[model samples]
Target: MADRATMERIWEAHTAGEFVAQDVEATMDDDPIVVHVPTAMGGSGYDGVKDFYARWFIGRNPDDFTVRSISRTVGDDSLVDEMIVSFTHDIEVPWVLPGLAPTGQQVRIPVIAVVDFRGPRVRSERIYWDQTAVLARRRSC
Candidate 1:
């Protein structure tokens, strides 16, 4: 089991845009699973699963981002959350979908993340969100 404080810190850090998430291991059958869904990035795992926010999502100063609200459901060693993510895309980067160029723009999308813990570290995780929503809002340079 993980301490509530530690879990809270992890959530806070994630919301704060400090993207050095340690041991954010994820799996298909994991408690906190980002069920297979098609988005701008395609399907599961880190690279193609959840869209990056810090330096990868927008490709600019990540400090401009914020996580509005986080609702958590705690378990023995697992935590699941629904997050409201808000951010401004101000740079150019690769798209999770193949062969798509960067479209610098600002976007906000709601997402859900499930995380399992091994002590104070995450053992596995899964995240779900809408990539189409993000892509639809992109602005051409």
Candidate 2:
């Protein structure tokens, strides 16, 4: 089972925008880790996962971005986190909306993440959100 402390640290790093390859390496198992995101924005394996973070997530800089936790459920080897993610769309984020330019709109969306762990390290993470809500907000902007 994964250690709650380690998982918390990983989540904290991600929210703080301080997550890096080293963090991934430290918190995740050496084996390939599966990552799933909305709209097929995900990858498997260590390198693939790293590339996804570099290109889609960590690379982009949003204005006033924040992720606040609403609730959490922990199990023997799994953890589920319900969160509110808010950010201003002042920069291009192709992963979230492909071929769409920045609309300079503020968005608040609920997100859920299911994390699976192997021992003290993470094995996989699946994240879900309402893409339609984000798109609608962008359209209105």
Candidate 3:
């Protein structure tokens, strides 16, 4: 039962950072799909998505995590946001780098999130980032 304000809240609150299951169930469509394309992370449908968030995304960021918006494009049914996400590699980020130990390095990665809506509730979302850029800093020249 989302309205315009809830939609706005979903955009501002969820994508700008992250959220918990209650926040998700209230703002997301009954059958929502979310994909982190670069690493093939994320999940399909409500339950799957909730599980994905619980296991990987939610509460996973380091204490120094931050996100800065670069730009955004809004449409009637969708929005695309460009952001610079920064954090200390003090936690194992399975969504971004699977099976890799934290190197204790500072990470700043550009992220693009494309989100679609069914009426006012979120229908789907796809996140993209450069895996090479994330890995390159650790490589020895």
TM-score, per-candidate, Cα-based: 0.57, 0.84, 0.87
Which window of 10 residues has the lowest lDDT sum in candidate 2? 14-23
The lDDT ranking, best first, is 3, 2, 1
- By TM-score, the better pick of 1 and 3 is 3
Winning model by TM-score:
3
Model 3 residue 136 lDDT score:
80
Which lDDT value does model 3 have at 47? Answer: 92
Which portions of model 1 miss their true places by more than 4 Å? 14-17, 20-63, 93-104, 139-141
Put down candidate 2 lDDT per residue, 1-141, tens digits, no spaces. Answer: 546776676555544542233245556556545454667876688888777767776756575877789999887777899998787888887667767887888878898988787777667778888888778878987
TM-score of 3: 0.87
Q: Candidate 1 residues 1-141, lDDT tens each?
A: 568778667655543433334223322222222332333332344543344432234333344555655688887777888878665554333333334443445657787777766666545556677777666666332
Off by over 4 Å in 2: 3-6, 13-23, 34-36
lDDT for model 1, please: 0.51
lDDT of all predictions, in order shown? 0.51, 0.71, 0.80
Q: Considering TM-score, which of the candidate structures 1 and 2 is the better prediction for this target?
A: 2
Off by over 4 Å in 3: 1-8, 16-22
Task: Give the per-residue Cα lDDT of candidate 1 at 26.
Answer: 26
Q: How close is each model in CA RMSD to the real structure?
A: 6.1, 2.5, 2.8
Residue 140, model 3: lDDT of 35
